[model samples]
Target: MKRSKALKVETMFNNFKLTFFLQPLHGLPETLSDTANANWPWQQDINWFLALAEFKRLTQQPTLHFFLLEVWSEHTRCLALPLCSTKDGRYWSSLTDVYSPSFNIISSTTLIIANPWQCLLHALTQLQPNWVYCQLSPLRQEQIQQLTKLNGCLRTHVFEHSENWLANCSSNQEYWHKRPGQLKNTIKRKRAKLLSSGSRIEIHSQLTDELMLKYWQVYQQSWKQPETDRYFINWLANYSAANGMLRLGLLFIDEQPVACQLWLVHHSKAAIYKLAQDQAFDNLSPGTVLMADMVNYVIDIDKVTSIDFLTGNDNYKAMWMDFNFKLYGAELFNINSLTGRWLWSKQWLKTTLKTIARQMHHLIFRARHDN
Candidate 1:
């Protein structure tokens, strides 16, 4: 199989150099800062090999291997990884590494050296695996379009929307204050109720292992109801503990946990990775109150440039978000190969069928409503 070529140490400065490398977790660079203006959440910089190693150690998964690409610039450095899970029970490949690529459409020279789509195509063509996956920030539309054009790639699926709202610290406060309308009224009512009942919302930076375990229990119970599996919760807890950029924002009412959110600081942006709410307190809107507080906290206290609601296309995200971008998943292969050609044809037929089915469903539903 043709693995991506690695650039020689001497010619690393030449035009658009590329390399494929691997290292152990213990051998990670002492600090991500050593790589010139790299993003925060230092654990992401631990080198792809080390990150995977730590993941393996904590999760005890023995069949995983890491493939990484290092991209360099005069003012910045970044890394990408093609993660493959070879475990008997698990089956998938992902493009999720630590640091995210810079997204400025203009003046972002980093793309010359690191093209994640190209790297992924090479991996797929060589491996010819079951599926390739990556969670792209909804903001990168150009990148998505480029990947969609790949010869044998198919966009198998995508999550519909996010349930949270993301915004920048510098956004107009007055606008936000007036935007929520009835939702805002509900929040105030909930806060008044909590206070009247002698309860208070307290945010914490550090949590005990026992508390963390409790948070996980709530998270697992909520997560299991969904069609997707929560495979990364365990890895996230350990990773957040090891990396300072990761934080847990918890809301406690009278010393008992009511809500918790897992947040990560990357570059100048904050991401709401996971959230859980206590079922007993659902009537009081504890989750909403915690989210509202967290939003203000990130903007006022942390001073991040933006917040990402992550994957979903939820209505709440649209309500408060001033910006949004579409996300796509695609598969690529060598079109000339027999298997690749067959898979591509299958995808086209499936997509066509889906479109027809959707239209028919809509028509039938409309007729029933009319009747």
Candidate 2:
């Protein structure tokens, strides 16, 4: 059965009436795939969210409740954000930092109203989600301020989430040339070594059970953390392949797959979603060899305009990317609740303790130097 917040229950302010409801994931909205509002349909579309939600339900926690959070004013929709949380609405996050590339909210009008963000605050006043409310992450700094100021919720906190890397592709040759000399030499040496050691390499735009099996085997052999939702990547592979955006690369040494990468190419942009290199092949740099080849293919053959390294500020990502961007998020809790106050107090106490410890360490060091 589909569950919705009661239609009669509404919030009215500034001549605008808001009627929002929590909808389940079983009925994903069609507007989720609207490309007009998305930068990457592959990641922003309904399929991606469904895959993530279903993976959570099947692998991690109890059943998750998805809400189609929409705001309306006399029939005109003002804001639409897809939200997922526990049935009780606690411990919620708008986007999975690992899986999602970006955050999105859609509406015919702006979210400048007084009550757009108060939806959660209202619930808290009525004591719906009592603690550890929701986090909306990877938002722009401006967006963070706007949402925090507009929401009546008192326990709102803004956090810097990640440092991500990206590059604007012009030509594969130029891209290679622009890279550091040391990286270029490393790639050259690794490619020569792999080729001399009898390596088989290929990039596939199609998805097959056999190829996925090889990827899983490589993942197990590689340094990646073990997956709880084993079929999550398989679902992504199937979807990306069917859309002709799949870019799977693998390198095998002595008939054994040692390294693999999964990239998605859509709308003239290529995103490096996942990659793995077996620890055994770390000396040979199989991961680097395979990545260079696929990057070349996506740039020279697929003609992508940009390449996204996706989530992370890893030392390796900065080596290849032309620039980096900061991602921010907002954590919202109702200060009216005791749990909320405790949470804020705990943060303040922690910060104060760190400051005191640092000051003592500095003074002690000065005294030691004088002695």
On the 0 to 100 scale, the lDDT of residue 237 in model 1 is: 53
Error of 1 at 155 (Å): 11
**Candidate 1, poorest ten consecutive residues by summed lDDT:** 98-107
> lDDT of each prediction vs. the true structure?
0.52, 0.73
Please provide the root mean square deviation of candidate 1 (C-alpha atoms, Å): 6.6
TM value for model 2: 0.83
Q: Write the per-residue lDDT of candidate 1 for residues 218-277, one digit (tens) a residue.
A: 565453244132334544555555555556776667777777777776566778777788
Off by more than 4 A, model 1: 1-37, 40-65, 69-79, 85-92, 95-116, 119-139, 149-165, 217-243, 352-371
TM-score of each predicted structure versus truth: 0.66, 0.83
Q: What tens-digit string does per-residue lDDT give for candidate 2 at 296-349?
A: 999988999899997778998877889988888887765666776777678667
Deviation from native of the Cα of residue 236 in model 1, angstroms: 3.5
**What residue runs in model 2 are displaced by over 4 Å at the alpha carbon?**
1-8, 27-32, 35-37, 41-43, 73-78, 95-97, 106-132, 352-371
Candidate 1 global CA lDDT score: 0.52
